[model samples]
Each structure stands twice: as C-alpha cells, then as structure tokens.
Target chain A: MKTEKGQPILNIRNLNIWYGDKGILSSLSFEVQEKQVTAFIGPANCGKSTLVRCFNRLNDFTPNFKFTGEILFKGSSLYAEQDATTVRKQIGMVFRRPTLFRGSIHENVAYAARISNVSRTSELNAIVEKNLRRTGLWNEVEGILDETPVQLSTGQQQLLCVARALAAEPEVLIFDEPCGELDPIETVKIETLMRELANDCTLIFATNKRRQAARVSDVAGFLYGGELIEFGATEKIFTNPQDSRTEQYVTGRMG
Target chain B: MNSLMSRPNPKQKFALQSIALLTLGVVSLLVWNVLKKTYLSDVQVSSVARVSDPVPNLLGDIYFFLSISFLGVLLGITCAFYLEEWLPETNWVRCLIEGQVSILSGVPSLLYGLLVVTVFLPYSGAFQRTQGFPPAGDLNTASLQVSSFQGDTTLFYIAVLTFVLLVVPRVIKATQEALRSVPIPMRESAYALGANRWQVLTKHVVPLSLPRVIAGACRAMSCALAVSALFIGIYISGYTIQPGRMSGRFALFLGAALVLSIFSSFLSQRYPLASTRHT
Candidate 1:
C-alpha cells in the first residue's frame, strides 16, 4: 500500500486504553488517511467502540478510565492540548442505535448549527435541509419538519442521525456499528451512504459483521482479542486473508 | 363434618374481626379530633374573615412573586446542569456545588432569613446611620424619617432574598434528578454528532427531561410556597403585629397559609398521585 506523505488525517500510536484496571486495547495503532474509508471488524467486546471513543475523548466520562497513547489529528495531539469541543467538531460520530432528540426532526439536524452560533434563520434552514437531503431523509421529513422525531420510523430516525452528524460538516466521520440496528434494506442504504460520504471526508466504521465491513470499507482492519490481527484492503482481507483468524472470521468458521 | 369445622374456627375469626373494627374506630376518632382542632375550628373562620377582602389581591401578589422565584429556581438548575456537563474534569468542584445545594435544601427557612439579614442589609447601606445629625435641630427629625424609609425597604429586600435561597435547592435537586434520569446513550449520541456539551444538554437532555423536570419544579414550587407561608407567619407573628393593633399581619399570615396549603394540593393533582392507578 502506498503511504501518503502529507499529514495523515488521524494517527494513533501505541494507543492503550483501559477501563478501571481492565485493559481493553493494548498497543493498538493505526492511521486514517484523508478521504478514505477504514473499517474496524471485530467480535463483540473486542474494544472497537472504545478505540473510536478515544478519537473525541468521550471515554473521559467513565470513572477510572485511563489511557496511555498518542492520538494526533492534523499534526496536533487530540489527547494532549486540543480542546474536546474542537476535536468533536472536527470528528463527528454516528452510533449503532438511532438517537433522536425529543423535538422536531428539523431541530435534531439544525441542533449543531444552532449551538455553534448559527442563529440566522435562513442559513440554519438551509443547513438543516441540505444535510437532511444529503442523507435522503428530506423527502420523507420535508412535509413534517416540525413533527417530533419520535414519530419517525426507526430507519428514518437513523438516517436523521446521519444528517445531524453531517450538519456539523466534520472532517473525520466515525460510525460505530451504525447499521447494527437496521434492517437489510436500511443497512444497504447506510452502506451506500458511507461510500458516498467517503468522497468528501475520511470515514472510519466499526462493525461486528464481516460482510458489512467487506461491503463498505476500502481498507479493513480485523481486530481480535484487543489486537489488530490483520489490516489490508477489503478484498484481500475477505478473499485472501493473510491471518488465519481473519479467514476464519470472514468464512464464518469463527467470529 | 363441614358444619362442625366451620364452627370450630368461627370464634378466633370473630375475635380478630372485632379487634380490627375496634382499632379502626379508635383511629378514625383520633383523626377526626385532630382534623377538627387543627383545620376546622371556629378560629379558622375568624382568620379567614380578617383577610378575606385583601386575600385575593395579596395572594395574587404572592403568586407573582412565587412565579418569579420559580423561574429563578429553573434558571439556577439549568445553570447547575450545564456546570456539571462542562466541568467534567473538575469533579471536586461539581461535588462542592452539589453539597452546597443539599445543604441549602436542608437548612431551615428561619435560619436563612437570619443569614440574609446579617449579610445583605447592613452591608448594602440600605439603613442610614444618623450619627452626624445636628444637635437637637429640626433637620435631625427630617433625617430620621428618611432613614426609616430606608430601613423599611431593606427589610423587604431581606425577606425576598431569604425566600429565594429557601426555594432554590429544592428546585435544583428536582431538576438535577430529572436530568440525571436521561439515558447516557442519548447524550453520547448527541456528542458524537459534534454537538457541544451545552448544545447536547439544551437540545437533547433538556427536552427529553422537561416533563420530569417540570413535574419536579411543580413539587418544589409547592414546597417553597408552603415554607414561605410558614416563614411569613413566623416573621409577622413575631415582629409585625402590635399588641393593641388589629393584628392584620397575623390574620393575613394565617389566610396565606390556608390558601397556600390548598394551592399546594391543587398543584399536586397536576402530577398523578400514587392513589391514581394509571400513573
């Protein structure tokens, strides 16, 4: 694989994360290039989510959760001196389950802009509409922007979450098993969206399903027992895995 | 055989039933006496008459003040919630704030009144000192009148300040608990979307928890109203009423207490009672 010389978008070095004396990930490292899709595929409880959370320092909320690592974004250590608010604005995340605010669907999308000092009504509406349309939720939600998101179907709410994430215009987008809760059709829609999103921003996704990882990811990393067992192109990892574990996982012999 | 068996247990059953009935009768009698003496005596009627004409206007004024106090409490809780979210790194500071809130909630209202008087009244210079008065002149008399008005305004200031402190913690705890009940995942998702802590709280947590927060505020408001009535009663009964005067403040105090109690119960109905099955 050719390594880009200019500053990699995100760089993780010997990142070790722990949750209350329990080591979740040890000496794990990776770099995400600009405008590329990097997928993390692992069995349950392998610390994929933990790794993603470290990007925005969300793990700080957990009591006694400590990490010894260097995570650099745009040549700045995200963990050292960078403000969490700024880091979060640059790297958005979409969770496994659909989380909608209690207000109208429009508010959910416009929430980031509203909070970030975008108070002009016309600009706010444009941002909300553009993001929602990009996520393919505008057609369904346009007539009823004022309606509570709780009224939307599960699929619509998930799509709306994507729209909300995009509203912030984050440079590095992370999806944590984003389609874990979706049906087959919805999952396909999200997978397609991820491909489309990769054209503009670096996309990193964590999924337990190997097939989903193979389908959406350009560069895939197989995590096993808190280690990056294999990392390469998606086709190579799926069809011609160097690691036995990766082959077993992709062939359904083992997770 | 069945008839014989039924008679055999009848005596014990009868004794137990008789005991239960006797207990119920005694309890009801005691309750009735207490209710009559405390809530339904002839003195209560006189108390109502003493302030009947002025009660509505006075209560309207009190309600306006109470609403403002409620708004203050709401704002305080919102501030506290944001503080908790923003100062995650400063756990000790959060603990200190929470501890202060609990202490405020537990402190007696009368003590708060005393604290307010000590801290605000003299330091604010609302009370003018007549130390530089001319010797026995007409000017001294005019200066004394000016000082008296200042003292009156200061006292009113102290009273409102005391009331606000007394009510703030109840509102804070209620709002905090409501916010705490929100699922962490919901908040995390908001943060993941690049929403800042304030944005997540106001946009996601606040709206989701508003129903519960509003319910809590209603409860806290009722408690504050009841406590305010007691504080006013004690203050007026001790200081405001003159021995030979009509004791209008005392009458007003009692009337306010009754109205506040009734209003508390009415507000309570807005939230479902435990006796209601659906809730």
Candidate 2:
C-alpha cells in the first residue's frame, strides 16, 4: 500500500481497535506519505484521536485496549512485539491538553532529549534553544527559561509542548487536536507552524475542524463512525469527495 | 432561584454536627480525667524522685519512636513501590499483597501486642535454654522494678516490632495513595517523550509524589508515637503508683506525646498542599 507521492512512511491494513467491548476504529486502512502533513478529519467520537494514538502506541496504557490488524512503519510491522519506547522515540506525539512536567520551562523542552541520553549541559541548552526557536517560543520564553510552565497561558503551554516533542528530532510527529484549546490567533500560529514543519518532519494531524484540515494537510482522511470514508490529496478530498458523507461533512452540512 | 438540589439538608447536617461535637466532648473529658489524675495526686517523696528520673523512660520513648517510624516508612515505601510500579494491575499477587496490608491496618493494636508477647516469650525461653546466650538472670528480670525498658529488653523489642507491624501498613497505604495521585497525564507525557518505565517513575512520578509520601510518613509517625507514648506512660505510671512514686511524671509524658502528635498531624495536613502550590 505505497502512496502515490513516494514510499509510504506508514501503512495501515484493515486495522480494528477496541476498549473492552466497545469498538473505536473498524477496518481502518490508509497510507501515510513521507515528510508530509496527513490530516484525519471527522466529527467528535469518530476515532481520529484513537487512530493517531495507535501510531505511537500511546493507547497501550488504556486498560482493556486491544487492536487487531497491522500497522507498518517504514514497511515493517510496528506491533510485532517492538519496543514501545523505541517506537515512541522515533514517533512523537503532542496531546490535546498541554502536559508539562513540574519543572522550569527549559527542563520541559529539554525532556525528550534528556531521556534520549543527551546529557551534556551545553548540548541540552542548544537543543532547548533550537526547539524553542523552531516552535516560535524562543522569543517569548528565552528570558524566563528558569520559570515554571504554570505561568504560561494554555496556548503558550501547548506551543511549549510542541517544542518539547521537537527536541527529540523524531522522524514523525502526531498532533492529536493540538489547537483544540487555543485561541484563533494561537491556532493560526500552530497551523502555519505545521506547514513549515512538514518540510522536515512527517506529521499526522487529527482534528474535527474541516477547514483547518483542508488549509494545512497535504493528504486528508475523512473518517466517520470508525471508518475512513475518504482519503486522498487535500484538494481533491475537499473539492470532490467520493463519498456522500464526506461531501456532507466537508460542506459543513453534516457530521 | 435556588434549586432543591442546591439546598442544604438541615436534618442530616444537624445530625453530623451533633455527632462531631459529642465525639469532641468525650475526647476532651477523657484528656481532662488523665490530666486531673496526674496533677492532683499526693506529693510523695518518691513522686519527686520519679519526676526527676524520667531520663530512662524518655530515652526508651525516643528509641521506640525513631525505630518504629524509620522501619515503618522504609518498608512501607518499598512495598508500595513494588505494588505500584513493578507489578501489573492485572496481577493477582499484587492484589493479594495489597489486601494483606489493608487487613493488617484494620487489626486492633491490642492483638498485635498479644501476638508479639505470645510468640516472643516462648522463643526467648527456648533460645536461653538451648544456647545459654542470655543468662537466666537476664530472662528472669521481669520484676516491677523500673529499669531502662520497664524491666525487660525482650519485651521492649517485642513492643517495637509489634508497633512497626502496625505502622508499616499505614505507611504503605499512604505511599500508594501518594503514588496514585501523580497525574496520569504527567506520566503519559513522560512516556511519550520516550522515557522507559524506570525513567518515568524516577524523573516524574517519584518527584511529583514525594511531598504526599512525606505526608503519609508523618501520619504513620504520629500514630506510632501516640500509641507508644500512651502505652508506656500508662504502664510506667501504674507501676510507679504501686511503689508510692509521684504521678506528675505522667503529665510530662502526656505533654511530650501531645506535642509530637500535634507536630506530625500539622505536617501531614499542610505539607502536600504547600508543596503542590509551591511547584
């Protein structure tokens, strides 16, 4: 299931996920292109968040969570007893709610790098500065590197989270409703940042906001009732969606 | 307009307040009785000597308090860590171990004392007979003569061990609660950053939960101190009375125990909130 652009970075085959008896994603199959923004857009409870969580294996912590079928990363089985830590190191995630550790702003951003054994003070400092600069947080927080994140607004905390994820230099980054709690201006800042970030890192953005998906993603997946109804180039998915539900969803008529 | 749900239930509230006030009154009465008994007694010549001779009893209390608190906290935290981190939630063995700790905490303190005495007395007797390590004089020194440990070293060790058993479960329960209180998302974010279980526990969980753990340890310390102080005070005062000694020494023991209990309680209540706010 290679994508048309080039080799597929991730390939899902008839994936199904469940927590207890309740099904979340059913028979979801898609190919994610390399170094591009792939957006999964749908209404609430459509399993878009669950699907992205699967990529980094974050759902393993959820009690009773079980999934069948295969997810291939760089053409290899991602769940054939692969080490979750190694998988997550290469595939990072920014959650909907900003979750910063209890520490200084510098420590928050340097966390991933530190865990990856980047120990030198100079090295950690450079990584922190580089990531803060990358996420456009350097100017705001550079002077207050010693300050805790409780001082930051929700939007700023989210941007710091992005910087934290970026410090790892992951090959892929999953944004699960990254702008869900942001103001319009903050949302715009992150959306623009996502487009620029696509130049270097493969991104998977999950959002219920259709226009944001159309505006930001290179490839779009329209999921409904745990099924991926449509997936293609963002322009085609928006302009001429093959499924009536996707058409209703994209035109703001139905969820 | 106030909804019915928002309205307070006066009947239930009255009942609760009455119960609380009644309990407080009862406790106050008991404390007053103990104080009156200690302060209004005849000032015997031996009473003055007893008052002056608090060094041994004070040392004994200190030894018991420190040993019980240290052992309880160390063992409690270790058990809690094993339960929370090393074992999966699905493991029945973890559940069984936790159940035993819970049961131990609920057992009456008297049962613990009786159990220790019953088990150790025979064991010490057998050891003395078999090895002659402790001479018969040491074993037979259980007279009402108030020496360092109210007479018997074996009895003191047994009491310390018994109190440790009581305190350990409480400490373990507290540590578990503290560990559980570390926000799940915090651990999630750390794990998302590629931290293994050990790294996440050390770097995020332990640091975040430490204040609460300390609070729990303080609570256990207060319990151990209160029980030990009161039991020792009653036992020693009872024996001193038979010997025509002063009961004023009981007041001093009570005062020391009250101070320690108040300090520990204040710490248990204030520490977690303060640390969390500071962070």
Candidate 3:
C-alpha cells in the first residue's frame, strides 16, 4: 500500500474472508490515508468489491460470510469495539447501480441525517442542499427534490447516491464500482465528484477499469485473485510497473 | 398483455384457460354458499324467547360481545407488535411462534369455546365460590349465581379471552407477513444509517408496512367477532337462546363484514397500489 501521506484513517490488517466453504480474500492488508482518494482496480472476481465491503462492515451482511481480521478505524478495532451500525455512521457506501429509497429525492438524501438525529427542519434542509451541491446535483435538481430518484437520469441517480452518503457526514466514503454500469459521461462525472470529495473525507473506491483508477485516485492498489499484488502512487505504478502482472494488466494483455 | 397472450401454438394454454373458466361458476357458487342466508330467519331463532325494545338490542347483540371483542382485538394487536419488536432473531423462536400460529389457525372455534368452558370458566371470578364445573343440580345455580353475582362481567371477560386466542394467531401471521414484505435492502439501508435492529424494525420497517398490518388485523377482527359471538351464545348463554339475542348475533356478523369492507377502502385510500418497482 502507498503511504506518501501521514495519518492513516483506516487500517485493514491481515484480513481473511470466507463465504461458507469458499475463501474470497486472504491475509489482505491495506491503509487508506485520511482525506485522499485510494482506488483498487482489478478484473471481475478479483475481490475488489469484497475488499471495499470490508471497510464499512458491509461484508457482514452477506449470508455465510465469515471473516477473521481487525479493521482499525482511528486506531481502534472497528468490529471489536464499535458495532457495525456505529462504524457505518462514519463510513458510508454508494453502490454501482444507484439504490434509492422509494420517496422524494429530498427524503432519500436526508435519510442518514434524520436517522442520526440531526434535528431541526432547517438544519436537515441545509444538509440536503449542501451535500447535493457538493456532489454537483443541487443545480440540476433544484426545486425538484420532491421528485422520486427514479425520475433522475442514470448519471443523476448515481450522484444522488453520493449526496445521500455525504448527508451522513461520514469520515470515510466508499464507492463500490460507482461507475461500473454508467456511461462514459456519467463515469467521468462520478470520478470528478470523487476527486472533489477527497478534500472533505477519506475516499476508497473499487473499479474494474484501469483508466478510471488512473484518473481518480492518487494512490492505487492492484488486486488480483483476492490479493493485493502491487500498490504505489498512481503515476509511478502506471508509468513504471513493479510487477509483471501489473504490466500485463495495464497493457491490456491479460487480466 | 396481448389478448391473453396469443401464440402460434396455443392449444395447451387454451385448454388450461377453458378449464379455469369452467371452474369459475363453481367457485362463485361456493363463495355464495359461505355468504348466503347470513341473516337470521324466524325458524333459525324459533327457540329464542321473543323480546322487543330491550335496550335497542344494540343491533341484535344481547351480550357485550362487541365491546369484549374490541378489547380482545386491542390485546391481540398489542401482543403481535410486541412479539415482532421484542423477539430475538434466533431460528427456533421464529419457528416456534410461526408454527404455533399455523396450528392455532387450523383450530376450530368450538375447540377454543370448549377451552373457555372447561378450562377458563372454572377459574373465572364468576365461579370463585364453587369452583370446577358445579354439580348437575348446581348448573342453574352456577349461571344465575355467577352472572347475578358479578353483573355478567366475569362471563363477558372470559369469553373475550377465548376471542383473543382465536385472533392472536391470525393477526400475528398477517402482521409478520406484512413486516416481511418490506425489502431486505430497506432494513440494510437503515442499518447503514446507524439504526439498531429494534429501531430499524419499529421506525422504518413498521411504518412502511402499517397499512398491511392494519389490513391483516382487520381480517382478524372480523373473524374474531363472528366466531366469538357464536361461541359465547352456545357455551356461556345457557340453553335459553333469546330470539333478540340470536338476531343480534347475525347483525354483529354483518357489522364485522361491513367493517372489513370499510377497512379495505381505507387501505386503498391511505396507500397507493403497491408496485415492486418501489422495492
């Protein structure tokens, strides 16, 4: 894992995960620097999604998933001390396909804040507007927060998911292949949004596309077959590869 | 979607549709049989002693069956919600509760009535002095003694207890199904937003499914009213069935059905026709 910056916010130490009889990720370790965008790029079934899920304890929701490891958030064991519910408050997630509740867009974005007891109608509206604006969605959706998220375009839906996550005021924001299903334009918009979001919170993303990794993240980790093969500054890893497999992958030779 | 989904080779489907159409008349007939002759006739109430202007008969209900059944309904709904909210997530607890509900639903109302007669009635305040089915000579003494002594309150409440047992199973089953209809992601979203399991269930899941829960409860209410009315008349009211009381029983049945329809309309008004797309 790259460590050009100090003050790592999330540390995954020797995490091994299994789903029933099948081992998915083994002895994997990584560090996410505070207020920096870290992206894991890999091929299909390369365990990138599983890794991102580990960060926010989303992996626990998967049936039959068994894991043994310590994920430290801010120098304390995430699972040992903080329950998944509490840890998740500080770590938010955006799915690949936008998963929005069936409600007005305003309700969808303000869900987390409401659950966290961010009382006062004025404050909730302020949070909704600020997060939407930060995600570049406020202008597009101005005065139409009453509309359902289903009415938004695919691009706008993805950004709405970001806004919803942001309203939680999480210290770590995770995207599981945020643009995996989006068009090129939507992909670029999400990438730009991730870059902008890094200034406020630690960002970790998983993508199957190598170019998206190079475009969005400052630190890049290459995961293959449930193992992190090589990780470093994005430019150095792409320009001068450390591992043959990384070269093979970046050159479009083989996954 | 396409005129009964016309296909080049439609013989098998056509045959199935023909069979379905043939059964429609028979199914409607069965439904009509269950619902017809619901109003009490003179012959049906012939044994009942005729009485007129007896406190308006309160729509033919001689006993406080409606009030008692209402109390039973309140208790059933409260217990159902409590079980759902407080029960642990263990497999056996769920299985045990759901299994008992399934069994209880199949139980005959008479068996529940007999339960009230043989088991509950003995311990009721009405029988506080001479407990355990009084001697044959004391049978008349028992009813007269109890109702006269307690102002029919003991008999009324014991009958209500039987009604609650009948309702809890149906209400619990329906409420559980209603709660289950909420998607898993809805729960997961709440969890991700920092809600404990109980909070997620009560605040998010319960509110989303309230209409269905109430609808289920309304169904239980109708059944409880019908069954419990007949139950008390047979077991608790002694052999002297009054014509006014019998007419009141049928009226109560009709009122239950009417309430069900009203609840159905209220449900439609409160919530949009549900679409899977929302999930």
Candidate 4:
C-alpha cells in the first residue's frame, strides 16, 4: 500500500462510537494523509458521514451520542482538549446540502474569514474573490455579491459552500456527500474543483458513489457496517483489490 | 425505536378537529355573553370626534396606555431577542432566564394588577406633573385638553408596567421560536465555519428571525392594549364602567382597539415570513 511521505494530518485509533448502546463504529483505525483527497465510500448506514463529522466535532450535538476514541490532529487529541471552534477552523466542512447562512453570497464566502480575524474589507473581498474563483463561481456570481443565497441555483449554492469552506484556509476539508443534492453538471464542476483543491488542503469526502470515489481520490477507504473493510490507493483498490469482498463490491457484485 | 406513524387515524383526526372547534365555539360564546351583559349603547358619530362627555377621557386613556404599551413591547422584544442571540439554548443562563419567564407567563393578569398596586404603584411616578397642565384632567368637557396629561403619571406607569409583566413571557417565547425557525442547519453551518456563538447569532440568527420577532412584538402590544383599559379603568372609574357608559365613548374605545389592531397587523405583513426551509 502506498502512503504520503509526511505524517498524516488525522490519525484515528480504536475509535468506538455508540448511540444508546448500539455500536455505530467499532474500533476503527485509519490515517488521513496530508494534502491528498481521501474518499470513504459505502452503502447506507455505514457511519461514513459520522466519521467525517467527528473530525470537526460537528456530531457533538447528537442526542445520546457517546464515543470513545483517539482522533489526533497534528499529534493533538481532537476530542480530548482542543476547543471545537478552533478545531473547526483548521478542519472546515462542506455539508451535503448548501446550508448557507441567511445572508448575501459575499457574506457567505467571507464568514469564516471574518471569524478568524480577517477584519479589513480589502482582505475579506480578496479572500472571497479568490475562493469564489477557485470554486469556478466568480463569473456566474460576480457583481452580485449582495444578492441573498436564496436566489442562487442549487448548483451555485453548493459551489458557494465550497468557496465558504475555502475562505477559512482550512488544512483539512471534509465534504459530506457534497453533490448529493446537486445535478450532474454541478457534480462534474465540484469534482474538478476537488482535484485542484487537493493540492492545498487534505480533502476527506464521504459519498455513496463508488464511481466518484474512483474518479477523484488518491486513496480510497471502503467502510461497511462501521468497519474499515479496505484501505488503499483508489486505482489499486479498483484494479486489484486485496480482499474478495472488495473485488466483488468493486465489480458490482454487491453493494 | 419504532418510527411514529405518519398520519393519524380517521377517528383520532375527527376527535382532534371536534375538540378544536368546540374550544373556539366556547370562546366566542363567552365573548358574546360578556358583550350582552355590558349593554353597550349606540355609537353617536357626531360625538365620537367632538369634545363630548366620556370622549376626552377615553381618548386620553387610549393615548396614555398605548404609548406605554409601545415602550414595554419594544423593550420586551429587545430583551428577548438579545437573550436568544447572546444566550443560546446550550447556555445555562438561557435555561434559567427562560425558565423564569415561562413561569411568569402562568401568572394571572389580576395578580399582576395586585402586584402593581402594592409593589409598583409607589414608584410609578416616572414622569412628573408638567407645568401648564391642570390637575383635574378635563374628561367631562373637551376631546383632549392638556389637563389629562397631569396629576399622577403614576396610573400610567402602573398600567404600563403591569401590562409588560403580563405579556413578557409570550414575547420571549415568540422571539425564541422565531430564532428557532431560522433552521438549525443554518446555525450549524455558521458554527462549522468557525464563528463563535455571538457572531453566528448576531449575523445570521437575528436577521433571519426579524420578521417573527416583529410579529411577536405586535401580538404582545395588542394584548397589552386590550387589557390596559380594563385594569387602568378599574382604578380611574372607582370600580365601575359609569365613566365609559356614554354612548359614543365606548365607540371611541372600540375604534382605538380596531385601529391599533389593524395597524399592527399591517406592520407584521410588511416582511413575509422567512424560513430557511422555504428556500
């Protein structure tokens, strides 16, 4: 199995999660390499999104949520001591749907920038423009920064969410099915943006589409029934999976 | 756990509908019965606008009570909005303050009046008797002389304070609900973007919740206005409606209620109800 040369940005070990005594994730272990796109693909109820949410403590609000795990980010325990807000700054998220705040398109992109003490308008505008450009939304949304997010198409809204995440300057970007609610054209746009953004930030996305996982990821982790069934380079997993189940799943024999 | 059934059975739905209709019927019947008991005389259009007996006093009553009610409603909305924004549901302080306010909602209006008489009336004189205003308050004579403005600003103070206390819980609850209606996903998105609680609330939650907050304020103001005349009149008229018995004067009171209600309803519709889900 090939791995990135440097230490992984996220290291998880013996991660056990439960919802009211029913185990959701059982002693799962994985490492998220720096500045590479990692994809977790699985059938429904595989705890894919839950694992991504844990990276930023977004799952902290779930009721009857209990987890015992060591998720280390840059050698520090993510859940043990570091403040959730600060953690979120380093590990930004783009949700399944574009959950934009009730504000203008410009404000949406500049939100994370504002919170991290990017006060000056010149700097904020520059950041918004850069991120919007990076997400391929600059031309479509230019000169309309003040327009509310409600007016944007679903595809544009999703792209704006990507721009918003980029504004935080996150080291790790987690996308929870980023194109789940979007169309094919929007999906292609996001996939292209993800390939470009992987050069700068560690991208970990959870998706139900194995084809998408095969398309973009450098490394693919297949999780099934809360277990990491296989983890390796995406091409290797597709071409010559180490396990029979992985081969069968990749060959469309089963979900 | 098993998921809840989506639709209620026909029998249950029928029962619920019947219960709702019955409650509404009882309320209308009760109001009709009260109106019957009052024996309100005919409205004389000529005297309604003129400086006739009972006209001046009721008009003064409307102005005084409405002014204070407006202030109290505004203040209530501000506090509630701030409390919701600054102190979220996760904050222990919010839980405590909201709990107390919810308890206060259950307190009767009569008890509020009693509290005002005993505890508040002493300090009720916020505005002093201004010069050039007579002490007698010309209610029996003109439509509105400056006389009614003087002699015991205390009554106005008591009425306002009591009205505020009576309706504050509803305002707070309404504001909180409005804030809630802005979608938890929006707040979560804001928080996920690294905004502190304060930043997320002020920038996102409050703006989204503005229309609902205004609606809540209007509802509170209307409640305060409708009840103000009753409570304030009890003291002014020496426990009798004799002062308001004049035919056209009751018309003036009803007209004030009608106009204010219409105004507030108009104000509320200015902003269409905003919801993140709708978009």
Best by DockQ: 4
Measured with DockQ on alpha carbons, how good is candidate 4?
Answer: 0.47
lDDT of 4 by residue, A122-237 (tens): 99899999999999999989989999988889999999998998898888999999999999988999999999998778899999898999999999988888888899899998
lDDT of 3 by residue, B94-205 (tens): 4355445655776678557544543465445444444433445555544543343333456646655677778878877787777767877666666666667777877678
Candidate 1 chain A weakest lDDT stretch, 10 residues = A1-10
- Per-residue lDDT of A169-239 in model 3, one digit per residue for the tens? 88888888888779988888998888888877889989888888999998999888988888888998788
Interface root-mean-square deviation for each candidate? 5.1, 4.1, 3.6, 3.7
Model 2 CAPRI quality:
acceptable
**Candidate 1 Cα errors over 4 Å, as ranges:** A1-8, A60-63, A102-104, A111-130, A145-147, A240-248, A253-255, B1-79, B86-90, B96-165, B182-186, B205-211, B227-229, B236-279
Which 10-residue window of candidate 2 chain B scores lowest in summed lDDT?
B270-279
Q: Would you give me the overall lDDT of model 4?
A: 0.72
**On a 0 to 100 scale, what is the lDDT of residue A56 in model 4?**
91
Cα lDDT for residue B187, model 1?
Answer: 82
In candidate 1, what are the lDDT values of residues B1-279, reduced to their tens digit?
Answer: 112123315775576456446545544453454335333553221121122234443654465466546566767677657654565622555545555665567666654544333344435444343222223343334323322333334434445566666667777777777777788888887776666766776677878888987787777667767766655442332222212221354345435534443433332232222321100
Q: lDDT per prediction?
A: 0.69, 0.76, 0.70, 0.72
Clashes of each: 0, 1, 2, 1
Chain A TM per prediction: 0.96, 0.96, 0.95, 0.95
How far does residue A184 in candidate 1 sit from its true spot (Å)?
A: 1.3
- Residue A220 accuracy (lDDT) in model 4: 93
Clashing pairs in 1: none
What DockQ would you assign to candidate 1?
0.31
- When sorted by TM-score, best at the front, the candidate numbers are 2, 4, 3, 1
Listed per candidate, the RMSD to the true structure in angstroms reads 13.6, 10.6, 11.8, 9.8
Tell me the deviation in Å of residue A45 in model 1: 2.1
